[model samples]
Target: MLQLIIRRLLQAIPVLFLIATATFFLIHLAPGGPFHQERPLSPQVLEALNAHYGLNDPWIVQYGRYLNHLLHGELGPSYGHPGHTVNELIAQSLPVSIELGLWAWVFSLIVGIPLGVWAAEKQHRWFDRVCSTVSTLGLCLPTFVLGPLLMLGLAVGLGIGNVCGWGSWEDRLLPVLTLGLVHAAYVLRLTRGGMLEVLNQDFIRTARAKGLSGWTVLFKHALRGGLLSVVAFAGPQLSALVTGSFVVETIFHIPGLGRHFVQAAFNRDYTLILGTTLLYGALIIVMNLMADLMQAWLNPRLRVSML
Candidate 1:
């Protein structure tokens, strides 16, 4: 398992490098400098700004310089902010994003797993139908739509939670709900499908014949295999949530890495853009690797395939 993990991490390096190369060039190719302003600067001032940031160099040279800096753990200064480095900005914001994502992940699992199991147990019944309908609605509703509705219904209507901004626990509830519900919908469907398949196995019948209570048979005997799909789905979603939800964060006015990524892109902050991209890219790779490992552990046959 350790060997598999090490191998996967090694494979991720080139994947990240190609991502960095493509992202770096595409961003620079876009028609705007980080220094571009509606109020044009004097040519000499512009030239000085370019030189200071090493933007005066050819694209290849600049990319090489950036790579060199990256190796030394420097993401370069933020062009949009006078004195802030891209690394510093991410360090400040990523924790908030991680916290938001973690809560949402937990929420999704708590709600989704049980709902899915119950729905599967009650398959073809009204309860199952209702669960399916709810999951569909969850799938259909984008964050932009759901977030406002939650705010309008809960925050403004019932005064349940704060509408926007991030400071206290109250401020985070809506955004977390908005994010968690969507993922929960995904998890629910996956869990239901996995549960249906697992429950049909001969082992489930044997467990039932042993006089195991329905709850024990379902939760203990069947649930482990039933969760395989959900486990597989969680890897990328974990990274996505942790990195931040751009729309959800924007709507909720949460100061997270996703919002910063969008701002950096709009501002054409080259280093900041690459930094966020790298951060997300790395997270995704690591998360997927973890998921793969978990999958292998759950099904020993998969460990053979991992080789």
Candidate 2:
């Protein structure tokens, strides 16, 4: 396991490098500079600014310089927000996003897994149909639409929670439900499919024939194999959650990395854009690696194959 983890970490290096390289060149190729404004700066001032920030350098030179700084753990300064480094901005906002993501993730798991299990157990029943319909609606409704609708019903119409803003627990309710419900729908489908497949297997029949209690056959004998799909989906989902949803965060007025990323793109804050992109890329790789490890641990055959 240790060797496998080390190997995966070693493999992430080039993946991250490729992501950085692509993001760097693509952002640079886009129209407008970080300093571009409605009233253009005088050529003299623009030249001074360009030289100061090394924007005057060749693209290749800038790439090399950026990589060197990255190696030294320096993300450079944000152009749009004066007096802030990309690193500092990320440090301040990432925690908020992570906290929000964790809540949403937990909510999805707690709500989704049980519903899926019950649906699979009661296939072709009224309860199963209801769960199916709810999951379908959850999947079909995009976050952009679901977020406001939830705000309207729960916050505006019902007066159950605040319309927006972060801090209070009430502020968290809408955002978490909005973000979590969609993923919960996905989890429900995956779990139901996995459990249904597992329950139909010959091993399940044999377990029942051996006089095992229905609950024991379902929980002890079936659950481990049935949950494999959920385990596989968890890694990337968790990474995406922790990164924050751009629309969800923006709608709720939550200060998160996603909102900052959107702002960085609009302002052409090259360093901030690059910093956030790299952070996201790294998180994805790490999370996926962890998921693979978890999957291998859950399945002995997979572990042997990995070795």
Mind sharing the TM-score for model 2? 0.97
**Every model's TM-score:** 0.95, 0.97
RMSD to the hidden true structure, all candidates? 1.6, 1.2
Task: Give the C-alpha miss distance for residue 168 in model 1, angstroms.
Answer: 1.3
Candidate 1 residue-wise lDDT, 45-150, digit = tens: 9999999988989999999989999889999999998899988899999999999999999999999999999999999999999999999999999999999999
Q: Which stretches of candidate 2 lie over 4 Å from their true place?
A: none
Clashing residue pairs for model 2: none
Model 2 per-residue lDDT at 85: 94
Per-residue CA lDDT of model 2 for 89-113, tens digit only, reads: 9999999999889999998988889
What is the TM-score of candidate 1? 0.95
Mark the regions of model 1 whose C-alpha exceeds 4 Å error after superposition: 209-211
Q: What is the Å distance of residue 286 in model 1 from its true position?
A: 1.1
